[model samples]
Target: MSRLLLSTLVVVVVIVVVVVVVVVVVGVVGVGVVVVVKVVAAAVVEENDYVWKNGNHAEKTYLFLVTNTLT
Candidate 1:
């Protein structure tokens, strides 16, 4: 009876460890995706002087502008 209890405890401990590892991996992946989306969004906002394309295959328009600021 003592040996059986020991075996059960070992199995439970291993299962718990595996679950923790999986949770950590999933969390890391989620954070990485969010970071990538944020970077793309920021780039689009910064380069607003460039033309925006709705389709991947072709360019639709051109933008030209001039600005000077010294501070």
Candidate 2:
């Protein structure tokens, strides 16, 4: 009876250890994903701002060309 109790205790301890390890690993991976997503979103916003600025420059150039041609 003592041997059976010891084996059960060991099994419970191992299960608890495995569960803790899995939770820690998943939490770390989730944090990494969130960081990567934030970086990518910032990069996208910067690219969009650059494109918008270039578009305005092009519009000004087009207007200049049209006014010069008319003159």
Winning candidate number (TM-score): 2
Judged by whole-model lDDT over C-alpha atoms, candidate 1 comes out at 0.69
Q: By lDDT, who's the top model here?
A: 2
Model 2, 1-71: lDDT tens per residue?
A: 99999999999999999999999999999999999999997996676566656758776576557657976
Q: What lDDT score goes with residue 53 in model 1?
A: 36
Candidate 2: misplaced stretches above 4 Å? 56-71
Instruction: Give one digit per residue, the lDDT tens place, for model 1 in 1-71.
Output: 99999999999999999999999999999999999999997886566434343422233222222222211
